[model samples]
Target: MQPDLTVSRTYSGPICLQDPIDKELMTESSLFNPLTDIKVKVQSSFMVSLGVTERSEYHGKAHSGTFPHDSNRTFNPIHAKNKAAYLQNLSSLTKRSDMRTTGVFGHLGGRLGIPNTGVSLLIPHGAFSEEASWEIYLAINQSEPSLQLEGSEILLGPEVTCGPPEVTVSTPFALTIPHCAEVNPDHWTIHLKKKKEQGKWEEVMSVEEETTSCYCLLDPYACHILLDSFGTYALVGEPLSDCSVKELKVAVFGCMSCNSLDYSLRVYCVDNTPWAFQEVILDEKHQGGRLLEEPKLLHFKGSTFSLQISVLDIPPFLWRIKPFTACQEVPFSRVWRSNQQPLHCAFSLERYTPSTTQLSCKICVRQVKGHEQILHIQTSILENERDTITFFAHDDSHFPAQMGPQAFKIPYSIRQRICATFDTPSAKGKDWQMLAQKNSINRNLTYFATQRSPSAVILDLWEARHQHDGDLDSLACALEEIGRTQAHISALAETQTEESHFSYSRQNGL
Candidate 1:
């Protein structure tokens, strides 16, 4: 079929375009002016960002004493970025005053998407977080026709050069055809025929390149086109309705900014969902990973920053997982674990040479949405301990012996000195003889060892070293509680490292 022969210039008529805004309505009767006045208390701890969806559900303990309970649910996607309130109870843009409780009430809860409207009450955090709603992210879809201001081939004076209007660019940069002439697909190209030659312009000479426009950038959203001046300037936001570039100069922008993305992240423990963490912290109005929670700073000024923590060979310490305890070896896990009968990867850090377990990870991120996925390949440290413990976990019940609204949980597994203790043989000899028997027993450094629990003491050594009678034996305990774990292999302090990466598929038994 032949194309429509009839065509008109920009600014010559009007063209319809889609609106960029979305809207919704709410009832005021039930929310704005309730028949009875009421007040319900709400307390929030920290707020976390889940994925880019508007859901209102999360796990939380109930006031009525409930164990491992949760109310995971999805709510309508509402834009909660700086909206105003409309009621007392229904405290939202479209409020009815009649208060009703749903998801996270005593904590943080809300949906995602559209702008949020209401008196969002946030408790204090650090010194500044209380006032900030969110890090700003703007999606720009500047195209043609939308910002079209009539006309074509904008006639600038002899000295005026066209390019990006308000951008901070240096050399070799381009933008769309804006504030100048508008060109659309119907008119094809904006032919820039030099009118009068200052001096017969050479076909491929520098002067010829200065007056001819070559690069064009089309904005599909706004229906605008960008043009580069000769080879120096880039102008954008032109109404493609006009055909004015019959003479003079023109070009196009490479349209390179096709994949810029802005993102925000709400962190979560591996298997645990994300939003619940946010509500628990933000809703409780607690501090330090709790109410009034502070978001972890990930990337700043092109540099990434974050604290990577590993719960070492923590025993199945369930009691150490309390929310308000610190300064102790608590229970923990190494994978996406559930709240019930979760197992931890145990390990004797001393047995493994830095050869099997890979604690180091490389995060691969896609440029489009800035979405990142972490790649975990075992390092060389998890070797040798093949017959023993591997990963680490903190016991859950290790709640601290203190209590308060602002208590902090700082867990640490100290690597004390290595020591040895001997198991007293069932000796029924004289007191002196029993003592001598203990002394004569052996305690070897190279052999395996274990510590007695009730009055923890070192055990296991060679027999020859067992000399003096029991009480006055030689040094049997560890001389140093050295930090000999797989984590040390990944620490940045290594000035010189062995040049080998052990892979599972390698034949050398790495």
Candidate 2:
């Protein structure tokens, strides 16, 4: 009566296709499909759920904005799940001295930074939901051979990582990274690269290109990025022409050879990164070489040019250079690759007579077809009177001490408050410059200006200069001279309070 019907059903399991039926079998079976006999069934109550429905609904109800929807963007769920492990592996491979971590609330937001490293991250007030909180970390790669540069490609900054990549942010965040390359759009092509889940680096965007996912604002000393993702990032430069330039810190270190009469001078040309310079300083200390002068910045261009170093104005009658040629040349690759270690040109000089206790000469450093720097060196070769004065000035018990913010007589909190108060420029002569002058940091104003906080750097210099025998009264007096009596008084009170607490604790043996 219903005309025997053949039914075809689809299942959610593996699908299989069968071969065409034979002509004889088709004819033997009843013809089931007539336009009128076939019936289709539809379920109106069924619903389909996409994976993003929960997130979408939550975002709509909890926040004023929604996540970006780009059909072209592909996200790997597996990668997101394993991101923490990947970051941990990276952290384990590099030194953690420069790493900084902070807890951030979703509703309040917060900032994290590595002090004096020129690296910071700023999260907006509503980057996450009210219930969300995260432990954010920022670190710079400090291990030797941490990164490899390709042909003609130069690393402009340290390899930096901001992680716990599993955490999601609803809004874009700001990241500031410092670079050593001189900004010249015409001669250099700069781009930001991110490490992919597979351990390969992928270019995120060119600083010169226009994009909606991220924006880049280049400053003289740092690069500011507005990005929505968290990962490891680095700034890379490709020299478009020979005119492209990189900034290097040139330092000269010298020591009396074992022979006493023979003096050795070591000239170093390294990337201008602060960490790189600090490494050279540590090495020099181990080798007993004194810094000849304040380090100077050298603009090294992309041209494949060698560096030439020679001693000029040497009293010919008093000293003679040991080399066949007074001037020595260093290859371009050698200096460029000095980021990982200390590379220098050694010059040996012999004094004609031991009576020549004082050495005075001009050391000339020049880049072929580039800039040149002249350093005046005058010191007592035998007695080291300058070092002796410094040594005696400080307590010899702490002879090998490293000076830092902790060494300052001022409490860290008060110093921070002072920096925040005075870092702002004013019409009246009451800014960081005045503060520096008050503290006797009168030179290298240009260098200080290039830092993120000029006042903080000035204080660091003051600490280094007066680590020993530095009194809180002197600093308080200086602050008072600058019309900051309130801050000055507060600093003195806090120091006295801290000292009293320490004494009480010692008496109780706590």
Candidate 3:
């Protein structure tokens, strides 16, 4: 005969276990003791009970209203509870508007992305059990409290969070993050760090090095990572050699000084980060200066070479440069450590006559043993009603914010055909596994197996791996090798041709 136990939250009475067969009642103290041999079965309408077998021994200190830890104590619920609380608090700090959420089903995985941030998460099919589902979220840390960087360490991308940290997934998911570093394996060291318990950040892995648990594939503008767990993740880069490079945005702003005949030009070189550029724009606005021309990207190397800024091709008969040196040289350390303030050189030029309304010259910015950029300056010296030099505001829409399926160079129709053709298991070895092998995504076969359509997941990885500069001909060739029909191969080629023509037409404004 089995014991009958009733548990109720509304009942404030003491917890008791009673056996109908033995007609004996046990108190909470003896019922929870390690030495107790009694097994009580709880029946409740409002709650489900987990059964514990008879002779089970409790090994650790008992706490009120909590389960006892096992002898080995591999996990502590208290610590887990604390960590959960900590994560929840941090999550609350992020505004609800900044977070993007999507429904992820166990049988069918989905993706979550934050627009304009170049951050996305791909949840594979069967990451959870058939009955499991979750509302996953993706957010970028763009609020007042920003991530802290150590000495000589730079943040290459936005700090992103993909969580409900307590939710567990059976397989690894792909996370794509944008980075600004000019990646060179020999010159730079990059680390992926995750926020751990008590607000401590721990290095998850090095981008150039492979780890057993995680894999990182670096692209020109982004990084695709395979991770089993989820939390806050960020990319940090440290320069390892003088050849290491960081991108900088160079812009020239000009305005007429207090004297109408005198013009001042301010050349600014700042980190390519969005915030840094925005700050420069805001300051330029206050100084009543207008953008002389569109900004250009400079690949500033970490070499010890100093940067020189000079103006050339100036008409000596029409204008004369001020009393400073014709070329200004900036120290390597001063430009390399520029973050809070942008490095700039100011040049004042006096016109021989107020009637000289046009000024044309070449501004040369160069670094020894590095790259050089020449900006062609052609603008009206005096403020004319028909001045061709118009102020142009910065436009960020030209840059891609979202990268996932859209990043694939292959046409959508062709990709669908490939997925359908290779997804099924074939005895002839013309299946998704073979496709994965060809694409170099076969290392984690077990991870792909859990996905509903392994072929699609593999294609997604391929898209992320080559998002910046993917070659479509390679994929078409691979399809042919997998026994795809000539018709299918021809369709890919035709699509590529049509797209190329369309791109050419758009560029030529036809």
Candidate 4:
């Protein structure tokens, strides 16, 4: 199939060089108006460059939010070093009264393309002092995905030597192109050219090396073209007429939780333009995952975070499924039933590892004009424990804990002691027990070790040590009144840890 030829250019036109001395727009008053100013003799012509468009003679109304000016060579600025100097000079021009009056200056841009689109908002070097800064800031934050303008290009002088304006885009960069450009089969080669000293254009030396490129027409209104490089000789045709949303991708940012869930959604609109979704409708009907409210409505003013809803886990927890509130302050009320049941529940950090469940749903995003855009989004919801717990290897060195392939999520506190008791289990089950005996048993660390597999010996040691401590303090009246035996003491220690685990996980949203 033939590729589309969507061409964008910088339309340069001559403006009056000198402002009339008695023009009403040039008054000394602070309220300034340039439209009423009269033009005098042109000492030097000012060329204002609007983002250009080469449209088909047939389609008069181009698509909205598509920027064709980015494909133009005449509007490119130089590298960062030169751009900084140009910005500085431009700033000086605005500050100095003599520079404004000494020679003729022209307004370099106008409203030609779609209003509120990239081309309409983009002000080249000839526009204002902060225009360059704004472009740079916009490029970094990229607050809007649809309204992107290539930063100001260095305006060349007659004497300045120059090469072709080149932009090396990744092989899959151009997401969509206009329909008219696609009809011609010869427009696929990624052109490489340079500007000559005499103001003529010439092709750069093409390497015989077989470089690769990709072009995919998404639909009738949009086509994706990936080019290795582009130059002044490379021309595009009119953009596609209809605006569309090509695809939507969603992913879980961190951990999924039964208590609370977080998901990130990225909407890839057609033509790589920034678009604001008027309303996002989230429907949880017929889906295993349930929402606090059915058909949740979210509002956004051109922001990616259109819907961020969190709800407490509502389903009753099954046996063996640790609940988030399983702590001393709020004990887990386990139903005593022998029958096996599925327990896909999130729990306190001490009892279990948080679940990382992936959930997907198709959502409807409404545009400002009541147009409904449907998108499919898949997100991973993570309910991970958020403490940093470290274990020293046999060599007595702190090492990161790792499972088969992924790094283990650490708890809040650091545990870096050697469990020497593991060597001699005669009385103390593990090295951590012996260590706890010497350095008092901290309720939090001991409980953490108990939760993991093959670490029960470490937990036994902690229990033994705590019991020994409580036995020695039996003379206390409170201990006597509690009827706390060694077993009761062990439960107390467990309860203390459960309280700590609940507090830690809830605070950090692990």
Candidate 5:
């Protein structure tokens, strides 16, 4: 039988205990029951199904390239019968508080090169359950003492696993709002800080929510956080304050099927709040015309409700749906809006036929419309067994986004997931619309052409010819073509200018 593993919280080092009696109890069946003799086999089989071997060691061990069930040993009839039960137990184990993780924890090392409120990270939607409490531990070299002024303190254990070298002065900052927001900017000042090598945090200027210049807007209380080498950010505001007009918390998603018209919205309410919500559809292909729908007053007792909107009711081509909500309570009343922080889902619509091999999409989360922060990309692959639901997060600074004119970045470490079911799982069948939903909130990602930076990449024909000798002739020919193209552009410009002057004189009857 496999060793019955036990990890004691108090044990500082690896403790190898071989208690004969305990071992017998774990492996051998009780004398009172004869049919329960196969319990050990069932337990072992279940462990294999859950991929427990992959997470057996406190520090992740190198993968063996084969799972426990991948062995040549034949399974008994009883092991096969209890497989479903084993899978359920494995799922529970993953949710346990003490579950081990393989992620690297350390000081997020990097320097801030952009403006004070520049976005260094982006955490997209569908990353975690709406009810789950998530925390990301960051070890920076500096100390922003101002963060201690607002939210409650979180005490981290001195014993960090796979973290950076010890540093002086550690402060725990709260990511979520603790109480109602009765005050305005004073409620909680958002600080932009930089960590110096001498182990000190220097304060950067406060970001403007209304301006399109800021990087990202954070909802400190939200479960999502994107980390980078340069900095970490949290949303700090009273979103439901009396000074703000409440915006609806809604997620729009389209099913992946052969049908083009089917789509749905998941309306969210926190802890049974009474809400008045409305949706206004606008036609963009035709002259901007608003198609009004009756307002919905929902006393949401449940956490969420998935509502399907019929496509026949709205215009085709390009359309914008406006969703707004109002509530009477403390947390539900404060609805804040800024160019850097507008809550909406931007979906890229595509229709997939049955002949399509796979499903893929590029997902992002930005502060609002126009300002886009690329967060992640998802692509589905074919498999025999059903895909297990999973979530992944990382501090990838290379995520693709047009930060400024000519400034473009790409996804660093692309996170992957194989979900057993999507938000709209039934829409997975063929004949559905291929929609890539973008959940951008709390950051200005607007693109301005006039103030854009020059992204000119200089190329050297000599270096190209030397490095790629096989393409030397091709490189030489390309350079010649480029030189000729410049002359053609100059000639075209002169022709256009002469034609404009002649037309101007003719129109004025000069």
Candidate 6:
């Protein structure tokens, strides 16, 4: 029956936990329950899902291979499911040793790289009705002196899992914000000393947000292909130049454990190809381009990452000015957590763009012993002064599309500041894209390149490459380096010309 009298409820207040306890519950004995000691008790039928990390070393284990999931996908399901499972489990546990597997009695484990933050564990407890009452407490790690930082912002545990039977976590799982981790990467330790000093930070993980795409770009090459040691790459397409067509290629790489990743490439008709965040792969025919004369290779390793690709445009000896090759790799995997499921295993060739140049293209060819390679001989009557790039064609009807100079836009610049240094070509055969998203200081990458470099300016490029790609910081560094390199090269050329003139007079006994 409807209520005889109308009642008003406060709708202005946000759900919040008051006086959340901020200290770890000290167990009187080994047999004490952490929940009861902390004044939060749970019923026996109810289950609790605790957040745990099943370190490859912490607990005994075995089993390693390419993750069963697709290599081009990424997601953290353990933290996701645990949050869901916890809502149903609804009670806390005490046996840290027996909590690694699923089930209400087990602890939900996940891998958050290192320096994980935001304590968004699945708080498993439920309220049956308005009469059901209980309390939740969150206390800082009072035991760890280093964890207590002055002016640090941290959540002292919420009063309860304020979310409904389900909660949308801020990020499916917690991120190992550097400086907050107990273990550190060799690279992170040396370069991230400053960010770590910020002190301990904490967060509860019950929020779900999208993560940035890990867009892996690859460029194929023959004589100039840089990364040879870490073998992971693939080459495809015909050898010809069609100003309007943009053919495609792929590279595949594998990582340790059960993780593989793949990337989509957007091939262009010209020798130049800009790496971008793509969700699909492109095939040879659609783009008016073809493969090069050389074959590409793939390098594979069982885990941790590192590999590269090259895009080559080999114009014939002196006749047709076209590309010989332009293909990228498609990785088979990436880092995966213990409890997450992989994404699907399929990708596709999304689209194509024709050239907008002013020249009328021609289709000519040269036949060898048995195979025939198509070519476009420059017509003597037309005046062509632009710097053109590589040309290719995967097949006949596929790459007949022709493109021209104006079709290729002068891609603008970008910059980013990140955690590691960028690799220099001279350092380890790695090249830096005067325009790539990397730092110039790092020498460990497989392959990277840009126009050219001198010592001091190269250092600046290293910093630029090391900066996160596409961000303002890296772009700024790259721009400065480019200007410096051009200026230095120009000065050196002028100096040589003047010196040559003076030397000639001296030789004549002036």
Query: TM-score of every model?
Result: 0.13, 0.55, 0.57, 0.18, 0.22, 0.19
Return the lDDT, model 4, position 28.
Answer: 30
Error of 4 at 27 (Å): 85
lDDT scores for all predictions?
0.19, 0.61, 0.62, 0.24, 0.23, 0.21
| Alpha carbon RMSD to native, model 5 | 28.8
Per-residue C-alpha lDDT of model 5 across residues 231-300, encoded as one tens digit per residue? 3222333222223212222222223323443222222221101111111111111322211111222221
Tens digits of lDDT, candidate 6, 179-263 = 1111112211111111121443332111111112111111121101111011111111111211111112122211111111211
Q: Please give the TM-score that candidate 5 achieves against the real structure.
A: 0.22
Ordered list by TM-score, greatest first: 3, 2, 5, 6, 4, 1
lDDT value, candidate 1, whole model: 0.19
Q: Which lDDT tens digits does candidate 2 get at residues 312-381?
A: 8888889988766578898987766555666678888889888888778888888998999888888777
How much does each candidate deviate from the true structure in C-alpha RMSD?
38.1, 29.3, 22.5, 35.7, 28.8, 31.3
List pairs with backbone clashes in candidate 2: none
Best by lDDT: 3
Clash totals for all candidate models = 119, 0, 0, 42, 28, 108
User: Of the pair 3 and 5, which is ahead by TM-score?
Assistant: 3
Report the error of model 2 at residue 274, Å: 2.3
Top TM-score model: 3
lDDT of 4 by residue, 86-188 (tens): 4553343222221111111112211111111111111111232211211110111111111111231111101111111232211111212222112322322
Model with the higher TM-score, candidate 1 or 6? 6
Runs of candidate 4 with Cα error greater than 4 angstroms are 1-362, 375-510
Q: On residues 396-489, what C-alpha lDDT tens digit does candidate 1 reach at each position?
A: 1122111111111110000011110112221211121222233332222111122122011111111112211231113211111011111233
> Candidates 1 and 4: which is better by lDDT?
4
Query: Which of candidates 2 and 3 reaches a greater lDDT?
Result: 3
Candidate 5 colliding pairs, count: 28
* Candidate 2 regions with alpha-carbon error over 4 angstroms: 1-93, 96-107, 125-132, 144-151, 336-338, 351-357, 381-384, 387-510
